[model samples]
Target: MDSTALDLGEDNSLLLVDDDEAFLRRLAKAMEKRGFAVETAGSVAAGQAIATGRPPAYAVVDLRLEDGNGLDVVETLRARRPESRIVVLTGYGAIATAVAAVKIGATDYLAKPADATDVTNALLARTDTLPPPPENPMSADRVRWEHIQRVYELCDRNVSETARRLSMHRRTLQRILAKRSPR
Candidate 1:
């Protein structure tokens, strides 16, 4: 969504879900400062419990959680609180994952390192609403994986070259591609 001006309410409550304790705490504090009542969960179970009981007006979910994948969290949120706007965040930021999040009823998907303003804006933009999740289509993960492999090949399997072309770091590119290859 465009980062246009928004009028956020003081009564709006936000649920921040992420495995990273520091990140979650920092985000909660920031959102609280922006007049949002914020609560945090470090695992999918805790998040689901809170969601089922008293859903917040907004949710910020991480792609990976210690208990399970964030997609499960999305499912739970949609089931219990369809009115709650949900935004998925990930450091990976793969296209396939982003598309999947949209398909699964997430209002928006954001990459990690996004600041409090970014998160606040996302929640505010979703005040309108969203549709329900559809039946599972073919996940784009395979296609994305293939594309990444092709890029790695084009870079002659060189992490530095691949990172340069991908506009990412050598280690980050290597880590992303390593899942497909053996250790």
Candidate 2:
């Protein structure tokens, strides 16, 4: 898929799907600066609509969205364009989710807070080559903390619910939440 560098012309189009408004806007602007004609959608429905009508050559989709799972949009894009390069981003990264995304035709599965450059590289890199490691990869502890925070937020910030969901002691979850994140 990465036989060529970043494509130009109409096929240099990119679709970005994410529920985070600020992140979407920032990524759109950055990709546009990188010479892609970018379109964005904030929900799975909207993303699916755009993909069905005109699947772009490149795409960056979040694993979870307010309306639905972003993989639905990924499937839509693949149905329309098997050659499209798709990258899935998620804050709650898990091996099962990554495997599912890849099976459904994702080019790469990246954890949230992925640098725009990393996304671009994933979008353009050849499938046959090993990608360079991210310059600022998250530490294992940081990834764990981020996953916990995401689960905590999804549980509506209820300590007990978060703890139950995470299978951790309520007091331990509280202590972890109370402290600053690890570097």
TM for every model, in the order presented, reads 0.66, 0.91
Could you give candidate 2's per-residue lDDT for residues 1-183 as a string of tens digits?
232344564678899999999999998988887888899999999999999998899999999999999999999999999999999999877899999999999999998788778888888788999998766777999878988999898999999999999999999999999999999
Q: List where candidate 2 sits over 4 angstroms from the true fold.
A: 1-10
Query: Model 2: which residue pairs collide?
Result: none
After superposing all C-alphas onto the true structure, candidate 2 shows an RMSD in angstroms of 3.2
Q: Report how far residue 100 has shifted in candidate 1, in Å.
A: 1.0
Q: Which candidate is the best by lDDT?
A: 2
Clashes of each: 0, 0
Residues 85-119, model 1: lDDT tens digits: 89999877788999999888898888766777777
User: What is candidate 1's CA lDDT for residue 151?
Assistant: 79
